[model samples]
Target: QTDQPVTFLLKDRAPATLSIAFGASILWLLIGLSSGIVSALRRATWIDKFSQGTALAGASLQIYFVGLVLQFILVDKLGWLSSPGYVSPNDYPMEWAQGMILPWITLGFLLSAIYARLTRAGMIEVMSEDYIRTARAKGLSTRRVNFKHVLRAAITPIITVFGLDLGALLGGAVITEYVFNIPGLGKLATEAVSNVDLPVIVGTVMVAAVFIVIANIVVDLVYMVLDPKVRLA
Candidate 1:
């Protein structure tokens, strides 16, 4: 049958793509956390403004635009990377990493911008709360007031948002993967759509659903544990 090859490709490639998705998610976490810490520290400074501005720019840029620009400049002109395709680290670690680097930065920075804004807002709110004021009034060091009181309270909301973000990203690193030509879940989903591979599509959807559900549950449990007021059955 004409469709046999496509079916076989899905079977062989889907697992590998899922593996990459896991590793990519970790990269996203690191990027978001590091930038978030920096953003929290420089709340009212020029650095905060610049990083937040970059995030806004990232939000505005279409994935297709980012992909096209990279493909043209990095792949075409500079010749730093091979044509986009799924690569095994075992086969070409250096090449795969080189190809994925910019896309990771692009996606990570974009998402980090959103988180930075949330973190700044949350930190400010927590700092104004009575508990935070009480800690400071009791002669706690600036670091103690910030880290132990303000940051702990502020992180609750960040953790909540992060859970949802992680769920979405785990489903697939869609734009980043597509832009970079990494053989990832997003690319597979795209191929499945064009070819109407129902099983693959269903499988991808199921995987996404599982991640979302699991993440939500984990967030709730974490919130209840971290915040004594958050009671649960």
Candidate 2:
């Protein structure tokens, strides 16, 4: 048992998966937020409706369902990704990305949609505030008012929520990882649960918990930066 590759595999899985997950999340977040900015600026139109509706649908989807659908389309019909296992880059970087892409979208889309909704909501609220109206009435260009005044303030709340959400997703990615068979920290966690591997499970949980705590701290710092009212003690 001590010499088993399983132990080492379990140990290494968390960091590798976390790195990829964070990267994917960040990419999707940037795309989604940029889209959200466009959506907010065009509120009460078809674009807004479509954007919000898409976000709603993405949020409502189950990770497993998304994974299965992608697997069916990509693996069964399209013949893109191999099933439920890692492939070496030297042999199959294409297949590896194909395999991971679905899970990334499954995880990233869910969070992205939530981010869009939050951003749009925040932007709308901020646009309605007295300072925003004053900015506009001061003969500032629409772009200046929206971007300089509204967006700067509006994005702060979104940042705070995003930090917390990312932390939660980092810890809770187990089911998504398992459904996609990604060999990530979440998969390790699931396996540990089945085998009652106390050390592995404890270690994984501690790592995830620490990540969440650090994320919250970072969010607090961001809050202070965004709003002068939030002074650090």
Which prediction has the highest lDDT against the true structure?
2
Candidate with top TM-score is: 2
lDDT per residue as tens, model 2, 1-233: 13455557655675547645675678668857876887998888999999989988888988788778878988789986666554554577776665566666667777788888877888888989998888888899998888777877888877877787778667757777677666777777777788887777777788779878988999888878777778744
Per-candidate clashes come to 0, 0
lDDT scores of the candidates, listed in order: 0.70, 0.75
lDDT of 1 by residue, 171-230 (tens): 777766666666666677777778787877877787778888998999999988888888
Candidate 1 ranges with C-alpha deviation above 4 Å? 1-11, 15-28, 31-41, 78-84, 90-92, 231-233
Alpha carbon lDDT at 191, candidate 1? 77
